[model samples]
Target chain A: MAGPKYVLEVENVHRIYESAAGYTHAIRGVTLRVPRGEFLCIMGPSGSGKSTLMNILGGLDRPTAGVYKLEGVSTSELDDDELAELRARRLGFVFQRYNLLPRATVLRNVMMPLIYTNVPVAERELRAYKALRVVGLPEEYYDHRSNELSGGQMQRVAIARALVNDPALILADEPTGALDSATSELVMELFAKLSEQGKTIVVITHDPDTSSWGDRTVHIRDGRLFTEEEERALIEAAMRSGADINARRGHT
Target chain B: MRPGDLAQETWSALSANKGRSALTILGIVIGIGAVITMTSIIGGISNSMAGMFGANAARVLTINLHGISNFTLDDVAELAKNIPDVEYTMPKAQIQHEATYEKTKVQATIHGEVNKVFEAHGYKLLQGSGFTEEDEKRGSREIILDQYSVRNLFGNTDAAVVGKSLKIGNDEYMIIGVADKVNTFSMTQYDSQSIEGIVPITTAITRLTGNPNITSIEAMTSATSDADAVAAQTKEYLSRRYKLQDSKEEGATRTVSVESNKQLMQQVTSMTSSFQAIMVTVSGISLLVGGIGIMNMMLTNVTERIREIGLRKALGAKRFDITSQFILESICLCLTGGFIGVVLGLLGSFALCGIVGAGLAAAVTGSADPVLPVIDPGAILNAVLTCVITGLIFGWYPARRAAKLDPVESLNHQ
Candidate 1:
């Protein structure tokens, strides 16, 4: 809530997975808010419920309890198709593995969201081309299979895919997890540039270096948000453990 | 999603595994093909059989007499007068006798018939005149040699043969007519030296085999007459004519039994219908098997593409989108198979028609000609509809299962 207006607000959300083996409480209670044009990093260890929160935020899943309001609309009140429409029109997602369709070209991968819209056929390629250009992907890469690109380039295509629908909010789960530091830095810089263009971004990651690139970091521990002091302590401890990461990457 | 795009993607996914999809279609093809071939052949044969038997047998009721009965020519006349639906009656008698035409000698079965026999029965007078009513009553010595008889006795069916004389059992008679190409004549079996002829009943007994008995009487029903009604009236008339009283106290049995060809024809038709019903049921099982094959393949696809399903769902695909995609693919596969089966079945029926035609030609006239298949549009429509239903029924489960899959789990699937 540090920017001009709040784009997303969650109140005490919880998620549970039930199976024949047992019921798993993947998320307990977590409350959060993201203002428009703000870069928010959600930092957590493995099994710390950050991914569950990301999934709920991306509307890939519904929360078991509490409110998820996107742009003041109570998302929990919407049906599955409405939520899907919300995701298609208002939200975009990027995954850690750069989940580009393996056999599809870069432009086609970027144009996936447009398929759900009533946009004219002739306009889809133009929009996808503009998105790819914004992500600094060369024209040659537009026709090449997205999966065949280098880790950084593939992540770039994933970013272009997220931006193609002109979504107000982008949720990226570990956007730089598989890349070397330099490539990760480049991808993070792209996210920084998109935020400058007034796109609200939420990047989920375990790396403090990645979190530091955001405007503010929100740390999750045991399925709950840490206090400001606790977040600062965790970030400082993580920095101590992997010292001089930002300096090593020549980031200010 | 755009309908066109959805279909294109669905088709692309199905065609990706070319070999498996082809095999699934082949199963449907074989099933539909079997149904088509079976129905076509059954219809063709049934039609031909109905044409042969239904045409004559349904209208003509023949009553065979046992000699102990008192039923006579007067009874035949009484039935015509008394029974409201009895259109007419013709009494028939036949006897085998030796005949000679100059140096030629032959055995001939002589049919003693009235003038109505030529028209009532399917007897075509190929060459000469049929008997007049006066000729029948006067017991004229006019004789009608069938073409086979002319060929055997006169060596040909020449116009002069009609005027020539043939001696039957030492009684000389002039042949006044030559006739053939009738159902009765054609159905008669004759050795090379044997022949058949027809004469007026009044003359036949003395000149032919000395048979004074009419073996049977045929009754033609009015066009509007219910066959069962006519048969019952005829039977009642015969029982009364033979003096069989209903003495229940003495338990007197019937003196003569009455039979109707119409009843026998009804039994035959029922039997044919039952056979066709059984064939249709069997064809249904084949299509079911084809449907099961599609279900099996679709289930495999659902299981294999769990991750793809997740990806699609995450990409904002609603459950209906997922369901329709899979169902459309199944329909495409099954309909393709059905079309192929239809083509194969038609081709197969034509081939079978060729084989059956040759066999029939040999049986009928010893010359082969191709018999065309009688295509039943109802059966084809039934088959095509079955294909669509099979697709919908079988494809539904896997598609629903796919649609219900959790996006998070599927996206994480390897």
Candidate 2:
């Protein structure tokens, strides 16, 4: 099959952070491309610049240098308002912390992005419920406040919020970072199901265990792509070994 | 943002922080209450004074002349007959004497007048009969006691003293009747005097001090409208008759000067207005302080809700939308406070009137008690508008700061 059309194109992007000590280079001339409906993951140790690249791609921050295009629109050339509009229209984000408004109900949290959109209130609420339903949360949990929910529940709520807007790209930064091993597995399964529904999902994480959930893995070290082939091969092998073990145990 | 949405949001937020919102509103209530109470009290006093003057039918030009050395009773009668607008003139020989009625000695003033004086001047008798033309022809020594003195000396009976003889010093005079409450001209100046008695001019002069000379001349006019002009004209006439020269304007400043009640009324009005102004000013300070409190609270609220602002921006809210939400919240707060304040102020003013025993009058001038808070509706409207504008003034800067916050940085903040 031919490679899918590129939904996102990044060329020689650099990100610099200013601190009291001095300026720190987070991303160094990173170049990458993401195809439509591809489930991709970036994995590395701490300070790998994976999250930095995810931030730039999500329009949460502008890159210090170079250009990136989202759906043929150059992000580098857009003004702040235009960039915000682009993010609202095309990008959805899920953070490790969930970043849900503590005062808002789960349904209201999900409906937040739709508030900025031209969608009617009833339609926005319906779409939010549908997204939550897709993530396996009960309809009754819609009224539950964010702080009242468990770690896994909160992440699911965040996922529902991200999907409610029906954006083209989903950028999740360490989405399972706060969950336990079992809860992390549940969240990863939700991401996998979203990907199966033709979503272009990019997850950035430092955990190799979490990276195993993605269809393809790209490893980064010191702000550069270290070994894409080796990372994908390793993830594929781990999945195969798990399938073999489950089959031997007679599990479906 | 829609107004309905903003209102709902503001209400919800205020409810969430009930204590803070109540405290902020309390400031405004007290401020408005103070203004209303002060103005009402001052207005009440002025109204009472006006009522007193109105009841007496006193004109600004009506002045009582005392100690006219050369003017006789015949001269006073001649002037009344000659003057153009002068309705009636009476040579009043007023004397304070102790009278014994059933052994209770009461101090009284005997005012002497002829029959024509009572007819032209507007004097109403409450009980018994007034002196007739025959009594004037006979020069009868008969007295009229006021209702207050009658109650003090003869108890609550409405029985007439018309035939009873009352001893005054060595001479005894027959009591003709009881007069109604005398509208004393200078009672406001002297609270101790009772304004208690009246008798015919001949009786007062003959039965009391036996002084044939009249002390003062009391005159009333035919028309109330041109009473002041009549007074000025009378003063000119008196200045020529008394051979007095004008002290200031090269005309005549007569010893028998004619004055109007309008000057006294104006003085009372100005005094009341200044008092009201001072009180309103003090209340204004309170309102100013209350506005400051609102501003301080709104600022704190903005700082506390920075994360919520960031979330709103990320969700697609524009800067104006965020600013509008907060400014609306502030106005709503102040309006709530102002409403309570007006109600409390009105109640407070009523309570003050009750306490002072000066029944409620029109809060404004000219009209009677129709519109409550009798002053300008503009005063209350201006107060409400002031609060609303204050909210906008105080709430704008904080709202702008909130709208300008970077979503990424704010979200990253713990």
Candidate 3:
């Protein structure tokens, strides 16, 4: 059988959470596809279900009523441990807080993923060093504890950690949410550079400026995806209704 | 994850909170230490009690006749011949008298016995030979002085009192031999100023006391026979021969007392073992409490490291991986405490033995060897096994909780 043409495929996925109070439809019907080596950004407001989508895409969770495939393998069929294995070998995640072990050295943090993958000890350090070099982290800072580094340096270490495993897709959630604008620009530039190198990247964020770095941006509202043109139309229509209200207020 | 990696992770996690880890194992240390100390001391006491007699002490019995008895050497030989299990029998008698050797004088309890008494009591002849049967037959005034009596009448035990004349109750007897002090198990240590000596039964009867009566007979049972049974048979034979009655009614005066070494040993062994059992139960309670402490600390560790557990899971750690890591940590803690407890207990037992020995020397016996604690390898092995089992029992629930955590929720935990 031929391998999958797209790195990720999600069709009509739905997510529902049940609690003592009632049921919550976090995701209704969402479909998405990203071809190999494509940089896609999924943008949404708070509570807009972007995180839920990211969780499904990263195989951290299973879709309730959809077939989500990664590299031609359906993830919904995999058990918890198999999903964890998929995450370990096929996906890399970067969080907004730069979730590095606080007291561990930067090099150690970068090598953490390989430890779980049963990688050889000798190659782990070499791959971590290569990842660090690619992310432009200074060699002197490799031995320092992650908490001792600046915000930007810590994020760089996290990106190195994500890149060390060489996953098929890099999923970063608000990669620059904690950094200043200048440091954010530097991080986005690094992601752009990784994209230019034919590395498939998906960045989930609310900031338009952050999303602008991606090759394509998709907006989500009420658990539904919208293209750029459709999002513009929705914004213009909402503005038109507000203008009509102002005109009536003037007459009153 | 690889075993090396797992071990490294456990190390770092435990070392991160060194003070808490040390405090957590304190209960285990005390628990194991108490068990080790109690077993050592109790075991030592039991061993020394057995050591009080020679290794084959259970093979000997003593028969004492009282109240105008007419027991004689001929009767002892007759009893030895009649009793099926009796191997041999010797006559014994004791008399207190003042003894002197040229300006040195001492009070002594002189035993009238043959060489068999020295053999049965583990007495070593340090200087000279024992008296022969010829001397006993001739009723010669020859005596053998022990080291204590030798020291008392000759001013020092180093001087050979052999071939010298020693006045006893106005009769000067020739000293034929000098024997080492008999091991009475410190029974006579309190009588510091007194001495003891041995003489032929014939001489003691004809010369010293002017009596031809015997009072005590020491008998050794055959190796295959029980000492207690032999003693009973000996008593029955003597009772039948002498027409003795056990009742203390009017005019019933003759009685025989037969005691076996096995009987005395049985009583002492039962008492010591029961004491040991009670003490072990008390220590077991402490061990239980230690296990509970381990469980409490493990639970806290799981709660504190929720985010870490999440990250590891996301990095491909399975439930088994997480569980083993925590379990190994718990085992390490317990094993460390167990080993240290064993060392401390051994040291404590040694110190206690020294103190006991010193107290005995100063307040009771002048000198006796300290009771050495038995270092049982089986007990140490059991202690180690207990630690591991404790770790598994107490670490299971907490480790399960950690492994069962949802990665998403745990990663989002603040």
Candidate 4:
């Protein structure tokens, strides 16, 4: 792998949020590269702006000023329709809340992405079934409604929905944040298995343990990515300032 | 999206909020149903009224000369020639007489009339033919018998008696035909002679009256003729022509009053039109309210499904697709309501027809058999089309609002 093909790339991205409190720089001059098949984790405390960067990477939001290339296609140059097309075909997203439609059957929820895709109508259900099977959901659960499922099972169905389109990169924003440790471990094991199968995955979380599951971890704080030493120093200063550093981390 | 797929998606969306959808649809159903019911009832009433007065009766004018015993066939013909749009004119005279046919004698009416009077009065012939123009010219003694005269002579109406001679006072006359039973509410005479017999004007003037005097003259204006204006013209003409004989008292004058069916028919028409207008307005208000309800419900649908909208957009739905989905959903609801309305309207119309028909028949004919509803397929089609258009119009704003929502914002909606 002398010349690694980058599945995602972001350069000098900046995001500014304006409220009644005036402008807050959510992301400042952040540059990062995600190589193919690399399981990467972004670690940050509350208000560290990691979520903003994740949103940019997921194509759900655009940086106020920056260039983002998902699979070498510059996202900033694309319009809404094209961006939607890119999200539908080349990238997958998993949210902390398991954004499956509660009223839909598990199978129907998983097949949603296929509705927008150019895939033949007949192949959509079969693809959805395969994705559900890969997420370790039994065939019997495929017909059940999302609202009927436990928290862990819902997350699995969400993951299955993401994989149904077979995108090159999967972005997980705290995929197991709402799950118990045992279920979290099961989810991380699934991510590990996906990594073994040569799928590039980027997960955003504040848990060092969760980050450890990735091949590499990057810490972000105060609207910028920092070195490990710099991150440790920031935490020490936050502790001294009574910012509750213990609670900053998802797990102690 | 394919229409079938869109329909399937809409169905799914509606079923999720079943109560709201049903209620919204019900509003439309009630509105459309009421419109059909009113249309049917009004249609029936107009039909019955038209049946009672013969079709051309709307243009017929009755001229009665007071203190003057006679006007003649020549007088009516001269009126037709002088009046600008007057289509034709006929003469009629009536008196009571003791009619004896083949030994049976009955006091009955004897009318001096022509063939045109039969059509103007909607009198259908039951036996033999009517008197012709030649009969009037040759002063033929042919007569058309009425039901009363037929029963008096034969004890029951018999077709064989049509060719026989019947004596009225002293002269014996050959019966030419018999007429169907008719409603004679304002048909000039109500005595026993009013419907019992009809004879040529020539025969009446020469044999019955021994003079060229007619009781009244009937003038039928042409279709394009303004009955009101022509009526005024006829009245003016009659007043100008009928000279008063010098009365024994001062300030006494002879004037012929001209009465046209135009005024009576216009009154009936205007009354019914007013009723139709009021009922239509009520139905229109209900439909308008129904549309507003749809708008309210569709807006709520958009608000509640923000996350779903975002998800669909992320999944590859365009702005147009999202708009199409919401609009299709509303249209589906309205169309369902419309279908139900049409069915309910049909049932209500049938029921209304039965009730009205039974009441009319019992009051008039003493029977209870039901009459079929007056179904105008064109009206039904218009109602259906109106509902579809209503759905499209009412659903537009809400669907547009849903489409205009930012995808990023909606996806993040909790």
| lDDT minimum window of 10 residues, candidate 4 chain B | B186-195
Per-residue C-alpha lDDT of model 4 across residues B1-414, encoded as one tens digit per residue: 566667767888999999989998888899888888887767766665655567787888887776666566777788889897888887877767777766556675667887888888777788888889999888888788765456556656554667788887688889888875422442212233333678887888788878787768888888888888888888877767776433444666666677888888888788868998898789988988998899899999999999989778766677777888888887888788878888898899888777687675444332223344667687688778878788889999999999888877898787
i-RMS of candidate 2: 2.5
Model 2 vs. true fold: TM: 0.72
Indicate the fraction of true inter-chain contacts that candidate 4 also forms: 0.46
Model 3, A1-252: lDDT tens digits are 235889999899999888999988888788899998889999989888999888888888888898999988899999988988888888888889998888688999999989888999999999999999999998999999899999999999999998999898899999999999999999999999999998889999999999999999999876778788877766776587765422332232
DockQ of each candidate relative to the true complex? 0.50, 0.28, 0.57, 0.44
Listed per prediction, chain B TM-scores read 0.78, 0.73, 0.84, 0.73
Residue-by-residue lDDT tens digits, candidate 3, B1-414? 899988898888888888998998888888888878878877877776666565667888888886745777788888889997988887887888888778767777788887777777666677777878798888878788777666665667678777899888888988878765553543233454676788888888877877888988888888899888888888888878898776465776787888998898898789888998898789888888988998999999999899988888877778888999999888888888788888887788778877785563333223355667777787788889999998888888898999999988888889
1 versus 3: better lDDT goes to: 3
Rank order by TM-score, top first? 3, 1, 4, 2
Q: Which stretches of candidate 1 lie over 4 Å from their true place?
A: A1-4, A18-25, A79-82, A97-166, A176-194, A206-213, A226-230, A235-252, B1-6, B54-56, B66-90, B97-215, B237-261, B356-372
Error of 2 at B13 (Å): 1.9
Give the local distance difference test score of model 4: 0.80
Model 3 residue pairs with clashes: none
CAPRI quality of model 2: acceptable
Report the lDDT tens digits of candidate 1 across residue range B277-301: 8877787788888899999999999
- Residue B24 accuracy (lDDT) in model 4: 89
Task: Give the per-residue lDDT digits (tens) of candidate 4, residues A49-100.
Answer: 9888887898878889889898888888888878888888987888888888
Per-model clash counts, in order, read 0, 13, 0, 1
